[model samples]
Target: MIPQSALAIVALFASLVLLVMGNSSLGTIAALRLEIEGYEPGAIGIVLALTSLGFVLGSLFGIRIVQRVGHIRAFAVFAGIAAVAALSHPLHVSIPGWMLFRLVLGFCIAGLMLVTESWINSHATPQSRGSLLATYMVLFFLAASSGQFIVALGDPGMYGLFVIAAIFIILSLVPISLTRSTPPQMKRGKRLAFSVLWARSELGLGGAAVSGVVLGAFGIVGPVYGYEMGLTVEEIAVFMGISILAAMVVQWPMGYLSDYLPRRLVIVCVTGAAVGMALFTAAFGQRSSMHLYGGVALFYALAACIYPLSLALTHDMLAKHQIVPASSLLLLANGLGAVAGPAIGGAAITLLGPSGLFLFLAAALGLLLLLALHSFASERAPLVREQSHCVGIAPVSTAVIIDLDPRQESG
Candidate 1:
């Protein structure tokens, strides 16, 4: 038989693949269906923002829940709620109803992810940490990107798609729910101290929030952008899927490169590219051209890399105990951006029309790009000194990213 840790990793990866597939599919389906039902952009955006709110709340409160119950139990609870929540989408068609459903799923998913990450933390050895993190990143993006294509498999107008999503969620519970292994006890971090994080890594914290805006809007609103631009549902699915895949394709190379180069310069260069692509997207979004999708893919590839780079930088600056606090601060920044992105994206959609979504994103990323460049000039020596010896981290999210930090091995 495979070693227990190896089995756990495989199970978690497979389960996460199913969960993310269902989750990603649910988001696009909700967006497209809500639009088709004649919901306004502002209302749609609010519903989307509510999910981030729930996720933020979950991250804040979920540690205790995981501690009271073991990780597997927590996983089962969250998965059950999420599965039920997925099925509820088709049953209730009101804006408020969907918002509540999304909120619940978001909260559950956050806790679910925490449980998974803690489990992963225990399973990973120092020798395998870096490769494990990279694998996690790849699996996460691949599942999410592939899940977008699942939206194309069925009509969003009907119940079949929602049922399919629910099925995937339920199937995800199979492996771990049946396993006999003990779930890791939830590890508690030090109290969150945002002021310290900001003092130490302003660029990292600020960039994390900005990446949230960029990533949150793209993930939640990209399909809406495509729909309003007159793409067929299938075409929109492919557009979202392909764009995410482009990010997946680019991330390993970007991480490897950031290892050797200055993260700030890499961030600026990547964000600069994303800014150009966003401008391209804004200019050409409404047109029926394949080139627009190409622009989006490239834009997202660069855009997606920014957060991890910022995370790597943040990890380098903080001491061992300080790392978790910083991670919490980064998540707080991420949550703020996630909440802001949809509302801004929606307002832009309302005021400037569909292309306005990308326009707003361009503006957000543009500001962050400038911040990164300014940091290059103003905060050069510390980063330069640190870059020579800093360890890399792919902070996965606000709640559980530090587990993957290479520094954790020695700390």
Candidate 2:
């Protein structure tokens, strides 16, 4: 049986799963649709990159809306906006028009995530926070992975998929709107500057940026790559879905290994493995379906852990109070990298073809490996006498969710 605490927050989790499923389906559909529309890879890259820009802007400023209007109202507003944005894709087919809609969708989705995460954080006891966060991470990946299958529901070239996406977004409003619990008050906290965070742990910040670049680029362009490789819509869905599920499978084991070994050493090993997987995909991915799916899954499984491991590494060097604020700066660094990822990934695909995507990933992770090696050698000694245990966190999230981390003080 579920604990009362868990039972109490069922509405928030239900709402989150619905919102993410809709948004995730829309993201995959956008890439597939654009490919069918005859747009150049470079143009699609630019259009998709704008969504990251909007996400960064929303994470930074959307909190003000939450503060002013309260969580329940803010969620409704964001969800309403998101549903409309998803519907708008079917109505407007031009590049510029879709770009505008993508931006709006990104902004509103970030706001929706912000409200839900913050509400969950507020209600959590320190003892239960870790369990809750772990559950949240698992559900998040499941919803996102399952969402890929939603692409098979209708043809990308037609209006049916977009309508289905909008319906999912609109349906998300039902659970939260009907909940009886009072909303939690939003807390204002001091945020660390990037300069301060970098000075404290360059490897942590650098690793996050690199993780963002690799993950963000793949998220936007992987579907296009699959489509280019002559996969059907169902095949592409399985390819993307399995990759996300692989990340969820690998995170805990990787996090556990970091707890026993030197975190920096674990990071170096993971980065090295990621580089190898990226190269493997570049060389053999298009040769066969099994090779392609397996290589991509292994590559993503390694790449996804970097952000959370970086967070754990950074936490090792800071006081308890500093961890929350520092996380925001780390996220900002990641977001900036995400904003640039699509442009670079697209250009590579344009110049080198579908294989260019994996080649680029290999190069990026190789650089991060060098940085990790240097940091490990230079520091030599551990940053703290007792290193913090790693936690699984989604890289694309608002600062509010940082409060839910079990490492933070309950007060």
Candidate 3:
């Protein structure tokens, strides 16, 4: 039987899975709905970009919210706001109004993730935290991927899908809110500069930021891109799910490899593979439909590997207490890149066409590959420390990971 702490972790993740599913489904729905409503591509891009920005602010500020109200209260409040925001889509029809709701949704989702993760972190023994984190990564991808199918259940122009997203959030409130386990004692990290993080692990920081660029564009607008490419509704859904599932398959293996190999070497190989796949996807997209989907799946798989590898690499370098600060710094880098990626992709699509999305991906992956190569050239380590077991996590997680690091383990 699982311990109480382990049980709590399960309850939290179960709730989070639904929450993520609702949000991921909404991303696809929003893109389709905006297009159906006749919004410009640039305005659609701004909405997506604003959502990412809201998430950034929430991740930064969520610690205080948790620390102040405790996890259950925070979770309840955040989930409530998120649900209301989801339902707001049908209540009002203005693009600007929906933009406001998207920002609120992003902020609430970020807060909920931090609250839940902090609870998991506080409960987990270091011996188990690695697997726990990996479980989180797998569940979120699976949940998010499954959510894409919701599109087929109803047209985006209808109110049903929006209400369904709201329903998922409300359902998510059931698990952890009912749990008898204690909430984690949460706190903020000491701020660190980019220079400090780069010195700690150049490839980790750079790769995380680049991963954001690719993932942000893919998550926010990939469905729209697929539709513009003349894919059927069914094809668009499959393409998104296939890309997500492909990423899920490789996350653990890549994380395991990073445990033994030089972390930068793993980053280089993974990013390089993604770069090739992204370029192939762009070119093949014109000539063969089958090849385009295949290339997209593989490209996403390799690109998704970076988030975990980058986190593992960062863990390999930080002192026990410094983990939170490092995670925050790295999260910030990812957020900044995510904020930029969609606008850049939007511009590419505006200037070039739908295929421009793939070009943007390739260019981003190429930049990450270059960063890894530069790190390999520097050979700048002062001393190697004993490595911790690697943990896989999604990009949405915040800085509370310090508690899960084995180095910080205590009786």
Top of the candidates by lDDT:
2
lDDT digits (tens) for residues 299-345 of candidate 2? 99999999999999999988888998899888988888887888788
TM-score of each: 0.95, 0.97, 0.92
Ranking by TM-score: 2, 1, 3
Candidate 3 lDDT, 1-411, residue by residue in tens: 778766777798899898888888888888888777877665677777778888988988877887788888888999999898988886787868987988898889899888877777777775886667667777888998998887777888889999887888888889988889977676555777789889888888987898888888888878778877887767777889888998888877887777777777878898888888888888887677689788989988888888778877787777766676777777788888888887788777767788888888898888888888988788653233355656666766666654555545632
Weakest lDDT window of 10 consecutive positions for candidate 2 = 379-388
**Per-residue C-alpha lDDT of model 1 across residues 1-411, encoded as one tens digit per residue:** 788778878888788788878888888998888888888776788788877877888888887888997777788898899889988888889988998998998888788777777777777778987777778878888888888888888888888888888888878888767655677766667775788788888889989999888888888888888888888988988899988888888877887788777878888888888899999988875564666788888988888888778877887777777776777778778887887888788778878888899889999998998888888889843445455233333323446756776766655
Clashing pairs in 3: none
**What Cα-based lDDT does every candidate model obtain?**
0.80, 0.88, 0.80
Error of 3 at 286 (Å): 3.9
Which of the predicted structures, 1 or 3, would earn the higher TM-score when compared with the native?
1
For all the candidates, what are their Cα RMSDs to the real structure?
A: 2.0, 1.7, 2.4
For candidate 3, what is the TM-score?
0.92
Reference-based TM-score, model 1 = 0.95
Span of ten consecutive residues with least summed lDDT in model 3: 380-389
Clashing pairs in 2: none
Weakest 10 consecutive residues of candidate 1 by summed lDDT: 388-397
